[model samples]
Target: MEENQELEQELAMEDVLKNYDFKKIHTGEIIKGSVLKVTNDEVIVNINYFSDGIINKDELSFESDVNPFDVVKEGDEISVKIISTDDGEGNVVLSKKQADEASIWDSVDDAKKEGKTVVVKVKSETKGGLIASYKGLRVFIPGSQAAARRIELNTLVGQELEVKLTECDKVKKNIVASRRVIEEAEIEAKKNELWSGLTVGEKREGKVTRLAKFGAFVDIGGVEGLVHVSDLSWKRVNNPEEVVSVGDTVNVFIQSVDREKNRLSLALKDVATNPWTLVESKMKTGDVVEGKVLKFTTFGAFVEVADGVEGLVHLSEISDENIAKPSEVLEIGQTVKVKVLSIDAANHKMSLSIKDAVEKSKEYLQYTDNEEESTLGDLLKDKLSGVKFE
Candidate 1:
């Protein structure tokens, strides 16, 4: 009976040892635990080990100064890394901050691979930029990368902004981000969407944003279409700003669209009521029209008889005498009378003749020696009879 009782006691001791081995936790191992107690400077965690774990205020978080009770309460389950199996005392030393930092770094790596944007809180300032804390990872945002336009860096203080990670280096513990990158990406997407719906001959309304020497840029929605100086008006447009000023809303016609290059050819001229259409009805051939010479070319001089209506007088028709150049007969802004010779409204062309305007009619007086046959002697005798041979 004594031998049997000894074996039973040994077996009971072996079962207890096996259970302890199954629940044993090693140092440097990360595990989850429930908070058993919270104090101002330390939190007691139960890791299912024989001894409970203690996380001091310094190990609670990455913050320089922190209170354990402020973050963790009793019965809160938190993951912690066991720093020491036994620190001379019976309690284990655990670090919740280290575990959190490791987890956040993994997320940052994933974000970098996925090309994702992250929201970070501005925590403090750095030398050349502001430091933001994402989860627990610190990201650096340069002053110039904070906005689409340059602004005061301190303006971002305490403001939460979304940013893309431009550089993420886990080995060097460096993370660089840009707020401008995210904004530009969003704008590009909207611009592409705006371009997709556009087609040739699409009528749209827009606001003039600015004028250039070559063209003007208008904001239709998200895209900016270029209105060249030539397209601003049917008449001559020496300057774009003269026709449309900045911030003016105007109706525009899309002449063509190049989707591959994101280019739109636009027009501001009349589509149905062209200024040239009224030229034939208002003036007829052979009618003398008063006009101002606007410009001179090698072939002729362009004269404006009415608003937006111009007629060309060929070099041969400028004068009855030969001329080497149109400038010899007409200067810019000089007023002259021109006889309309031909009109081609479909092609927006009009021909005029200045020499025809000053020509003599067919009944002009002439001088010749073809009088009647009454001789000078007969006339003399008649005068002698009337005057008594004076």
Candidate 2:
């Protein structure tokens, strides 16, 4: 009788322990867990349930290279979301990433409402734009909203960019961001700052934004200015495209600024680098050079000796004979040889003489004619005239 009572009491205590171990937990439940073991691939956590929960490396963080030990160590308490009650191995599957995503969504929503910007990492590119990850949520930045139109969208891949949330719909699980919004705001602020300190004759480094028949438009610190074709270079420019192209960086001189019309006149070539500054290195006085008649004036004819450099041929110097006007001897677009009489580089002026060049040509021909007639027999006769031969 005593042995039977001992066996019955032992069976009753076993049934009570089994009932206590049965904790009613279902899938998709938020539970508190303690890290039991951590490894490179997975982490084991005890959730005070019948089975311990398994948190894989991918579930611990959205980053691919995350270490499970770095996320959770032994004896650390963490909140996790239940993925499955049984992962076919009788162990519960939990995700720490999914649990943190809920709070990230709330933060994104608040940022949208508060008009704040968020920083996101660009994961990849899609058909129309870029795909970025804000925490674990995917945010779409359209091509038009990705960056300024001048910037290539693909260059932003794998870079962290700050963006403004244009649309945040938590119910639909859709989020749209715009880097252009942030860039445009910064541009406007820079424009205001530039205008406050803008002055005529201010030198600036600018990027060529557009080309037109008359001029090129350049962006100088958020303000645009026009560089007229004539001012593009000292050399003649038929079109602005010949001097500058779109997206070219150049230095510009602000000639004038009209606040009322919002117009700016810019010059690309300044006096410091003008062709006249180096004219003496190319030619000097008394040097004869071939030139083309560019235009005829009442005083003389403007002849081009070099590109962007013209010399004046006075009416008296146009020909050896007297002339009524420069056009009588020289026509526009005619090629003529001229001698440099004087030069004033500081004033960008040069005086040339075509008559002197013609005279010098005659003297050179006469000298060559006399030399061709001389022979070796004439040189021997001249030397023997003062000596007696033995």
Candidate 3:
């Protein structure tokens, strides 16, 4: 009975030994553990070994003044490298910083292979480039790759930037990055989207950027469109400056878009407020209106009867006597009284007769002479009734 009892006890001890891990823990081996305790200067971790691991304040991070409690709390799982299998007190010595440095190079290599971007904090501006920190590693960004536009390098210090790694040499421990690559790609994407979504007759608000003799270039979003001088306003525009100046904010419509040729045309005149809409209500046939001669063509003269509205005086209607051309009897800017013979507002056209106007004036003069006892105002009012004058 004594022998059987001793054999049972030995079997139980073998089972207890089997439950514990007998794997040897060595220095330089990375392992994972749960934080068992956290103090101001040290962190105690449970690695399932007979003894707990301890990480001193200096091993918590690359920063010189970091506290152990700030980096980890109790029950938090962390990966650390074994600095020694046993310290003087029988606890495993661990370093979180060494483990991070060992794996950071692999992380950077993976990111580069996948064409992924990384976030870096600018530490300082160097002689030919910028020095930035990525997981405690120094990354070099050249001056030409710093930004898409001109910028002061010193201003970037202490700011975090997103960049693409262009070159990585593990042997030399060098990494080159660029922020301009990402910015330029984003700009090109926006330009392409703007071009694809555009349609003719879409209204947009833009700023005039440049003025030329034939047209003005306006920037709407990231794209530029040309506004021809002829399309600037309803009134005659001899120069683009007459309607819009550089740096002026204006509303425009897309007149035409040629994607193949990469040409865009814009119009500044508001079609809703076209002067032709006012022709029918402002004047009628046979009403004598005072107008200024605007321009002369081979057969007729264009006269401005109202703001932005012009009427044509044919050579036959210049005077009672026939003239070879309207310029023979009328000069540009000359004020004249003309009778409206026809109005085609839908077509933006009107016909005027200077001969008929002269006949009306003669009748008014005769009527005034017959009414000698009447006041001059009363005679003029009766003769001018129903006449629309500007």
Cα lDDT listed for each candidate? 0.84, 0.88, 0.89
Q: Give TM per candidate.
A: 0.77, 0.57, 0.66
Q: How many residue pairs clash in each candidate?
A: 0, 0, 0
- Tens-place lDDT per residue, model 2, 204-252, is 9999999999989999978899999988988767788878899999999
Better of 1 and 2 by lDDT: 2
Off by over 4 Å in 1: 1-24, 63-70, 123-129, 142-154, 205-212, 219-222, 245-251, 270-273, 357-390
Native-referenced Cα lDDT, model 1: 0.84
The TM-score leader among the candidates is 1
Winner on TM-score (1 vs 2)? 1
Model 3's TM-score against the true structure: 0.66
314-334: candidate 1 lDDT, tens digit per residue: 999999888999998788999
Quote the positional error of residue 266 for candidate 3 in Å.
1.6
lDDT of 2: 0.88
Give the per-residue lDDT digits (tens) of candidate 3, residues 143-262. Answer: 999998889999999999999999887778899999999999987798789999988888999999999999999998878999998789888778897788889999999999988887
Off by over 4 Å in 3: 1-29, 34-39, 42-56, 82-94, 123-131, 142-159, 277-305, 309-390
